[model samples]
Target: MKDREDILRQIEELQKKFLEILANNPGIVVVNSDQTGQVKETHSTRTLAPEGEKDVVVEIENASATTHAVTVLPTIYLDGRQHPKVYVHLGEATGALPKFKPVYSNPNLVIGASKSHIMNKEGTERFLKEVLFIQPMPKHMLLLIDSWPLFLNHSFIQQFVPQGHKVTILNIPKGGTSLSQPLDLNYNQQWKSVMRRLNDAILIHEIDYKIHVRDNLLRAISQVYWCFGAPRFCEFRRYGWYKGGYLDTHPAPFVTPPKYLFGEGSEGDCTCGEPGLILCPYCEKPHCFICFVANSHRCA
Candidate 1:
């Protein structure tokens, strides 16, 4: 493991290199985007548990586990322009559908639902076309992102590059997202904090009226979009390649253990955990071959 000082030095070096690249490429701009998942689980600042209990459990009535995937695009151009967009894509779980029709009519705030509660290829393509591509912009745009397959899709890139717009995809260094990616630096926490407050407000309103409906989720999400307009979204774009302060800050350490550990000469072990090793792309942790095969090679 690298020491704190070493990590900080690396971050500074990377930040300088990123800025130099931007300076060399005058027309290119950086737009950082990422997605986060939110469930129907209720979170409150006030606890109802007894004084001695360490855990506070609040029973929610008429509420199922409905997941919603929110994709936030905090665009920060090299020229320091501030126009960000937020997309709330809900999943198609029972009672998870949006009750309010036309959740958001504005182009900046897009709210919709999907069957898997995650952004599919079609949804990603639509976002790039409708929200990103349609916006008035220069000829060259560089989108800095993590290694999400949705962004690296060949067909999507091929389709978008030919429309008089030059789109360049810059994948952040593996395991270096915390230092390189603008959205992960501090914006995601702010967005989630705002969402949690909105959720708590809705929970209180629903309990007061005794109207425990799934629409509460939709209403809360709608209000979040309304509140997190361009100005609020721009606040998240504070950290990026242009900001030298981000490089000076030290990042917190994180480590993930292997999904499955195997003893030497264990039974039913093929290649003794040497061959067919499947690792998580994000964390780079080795997974048990059997578990990976059974679960369709998905990383938890």
Candidate 2:
């Protein structure tokens, strides 16, 4: 594992490399956007430190270092002028980005899961079926992915978050607690460290964070779903976590929704299905609540 010095040095190197890139292209500009989506543009100037500068950079750097874990910070480079900017780091890799974005189009729904893995997959699929297919896509989406991105398959992410929506995936590494509430799952060994392993995978990838992958996940999902008029996409949180850092416990059996909303035009029954009901997508699957079973480690 790279030590703190190595990480800082690497960051300095990247800055120097960026400086060189800037030198070659005089028109280069660095744009910084705050959480409000307000844009601020700045020009780069080369000035070696004057004879006696406080050199406060070291102190600021030290204070910022504590905000580890990816998905929090977002470094954007919008060369000169561009509408769509690319993320310079993966979601969780940057610890400064806010936990959620400002825009929430649709009414937020919470689907809790008994198991983290089950929550991951099931939440994704149900979002695809009910939310994406049924309702209009939001202008913006803020997603929280627990642990690492392992449970997610890129292809599926591409299918959701269709155009018209800009989704951000925030990762909460293992050993982190939700800003909202304590998760129902106990951290004891009885659960066999499943959540721990999942969290570790996230931390490993975040060591030297890269934004290309996160941008791809966001843009890919946006293009297919938005540009192509495909169904709207769902953001995965490795489990069911809503915006504002709210942690959802697995829903009780009676309240949980079904796996497939419309299975080949046949019925996908939930506990609430009425006897002799139409047995159709509209009747049985009332909402997009993924049964926690789908995200279980056993199924994964």
Candidate 3:
């Protein structure tokens, strides 16, 4: 028993060291958004969390049965409580959308694919195309995938063409899938060939890592891995985020550092109901939710 316990302790220490090494490696990051609008981050080697009490909020309003539509707004709590003030002007909600937010306190690092985002055959194909089309790729690229066809398809297997610094993908999946052609086989055979084509592509992975596909896969990739996986995602997601707006960029003002850091500064309420130092300073303003537009005139 004593010997076994010692061995277990040594193994634990070794695992920690391994994780540290992988986290520092330059590779890819994966980003995932589920029905709950919770964001998950993944990286090629490990996972990490956004540091703070921040909780991503997604609001849905005007929901009806027949008229179904979904809008996602990522946000964090103003105070320590569970109140997520982020608003989404969704039309209706019938089907379930698994929106996931990261637990910024203890985030997973960007590693391989998270199973949450991996969909059926068609979904996998669409995701692969998105990865291929992203322009101005980052220094290191990471892909989080689960489907065998999408992972091994010719479109992706063409070769590693590094337009930027680095590129990699985290292939995620459940244990008992009916995939005859495992992605690992294709990757092992073609990875070297692809690397040669890119000239500067770097691949990062740990052989013994057991990644959870359903829960942490998308979360790990989206929040952390996306940075390395798709550095140009800011340009790509905007196309989807701003479909309702003109000018190509998103019409909505993305949450900045100031917004997240400047929570309730005072004991009393500013127009938004949360206590903060920077009051709306406007009498007509109803709440702090719209204070961005309203208080900007009076305060700023």
Candidate 4:
């Protein structure tokens, strides 16, 4: 539990202070960061096995669903690494609309696409070395990892973790990850539910959207993932940390997805004369769900 870790940390601090006083030594700086990431087997696989937790709040995990799992990724291999021209060429279509934008597109995220799509041993190490540590982190690091077989190799993970740092990795007990890890406590389910809502929107509206297409799939997932950035879900995330023992005090009560997003707020009529329940935040335009989704209505 975070409370327990805090006590233990305080004890260590006290010991260090006492020893410093006796030896006349100075104090040291500690760099702290917490985050999460996911290791997916395929593009459309909802099968989620969380990779690790960087800290208590930031989550690096996948949303559950398989609607786009078959977007095949071809493997490229070379010995002594061929020149850049050795790579297959693509026209502007590859860079066209519907890019797979993540919640954060810059240094905050390090992404890799693989043929298998799973973060196997090599991929996990790359995530640690490249994506997870995109920037120089603090000297003292604590990582919360599930008891997945790949993470069992301390040396392999250490190979990617930066040098000159004290990293403490604690693996959740087997079968305990579902409860011990903050990311799983409710994060994954909420994420899946959001995607399901989008799926429902797509189906019920009978829109001719090609969301199952690879590019469209990426775009849709990005849109759904982006929804969590709203204040309601962002505040609800703290509850997961508290449940996972990362937070000592209970977080202030906040609105959840169902209560906020799913609840029937003030009823009104769409501009098309249809009865509407959802209002676009940007335009305050009341829109029937079908109009909002099918027409892709938004502020001009």
Q: By lDDT, who's the top model here?
A: 1
TM-score of every candidate relative to the true structure: 0.60, 0.22, 0.27, 0.55
Best by TM-score: 1
Model 3 local distance difference test score: 0.28
> Which candidate, 2 or 4, has the higher lDDT?
4
Residue 120 local lDDT, model 1: 78
For model 1, what is the error of residue 29's alpha carbon versus the real structure, in angstroms, after optimal superposition? 2.6
In model 3, the runs with Cα more than 4 Å from the true position are 1-62, 65-136, 145-166, 175-287, 293-300
lDDT of 3 by residue, 172-279 (tens): 333311121121222112222221211111111112221222222223223222121122223333332123111233423432212222223322454556433322
- TM match of model 4 to true structure: 0.55
Mind giving the per-residue lDDT tens digits that candidate 4 earns over 124-192? 655566544434454644455566777667777776766676555556555555555565676556655
Worst 10 residues of 2 by lDDT: 35-44
lDDT, candidate 1, 216-271, per-residue tens:
44444433443333332332345443343433443333121111122222223233
Estimate the lDDT of model 1: 0.50
Query: Which 10 consecutive residues of model 3 have the lowest summed lDDT?
Result: 75-84
Q: What lDDT does the true structure give each of the candidates? A: 0.50, 0.27, 0.28, 0.44
After superposition, candidate 1 runs with Cα above 4 Å error? 2-17, 45-59, 65-84, 93-106, 204-219, 230-236, 240-300
Clashing pairs in 1: 91-117
Error of 1 at 166 (Å): 1.4
Residue by residue across 126-211, what tens digits does model 2's lDDT show? 54444432344334433333433542354565566566545443333333322311121221111113222222222322322211
Could you give the C-alpha RMSD of every candidate to the true structure, in order shown? 18.3, 24.2, 20.0, 14.0
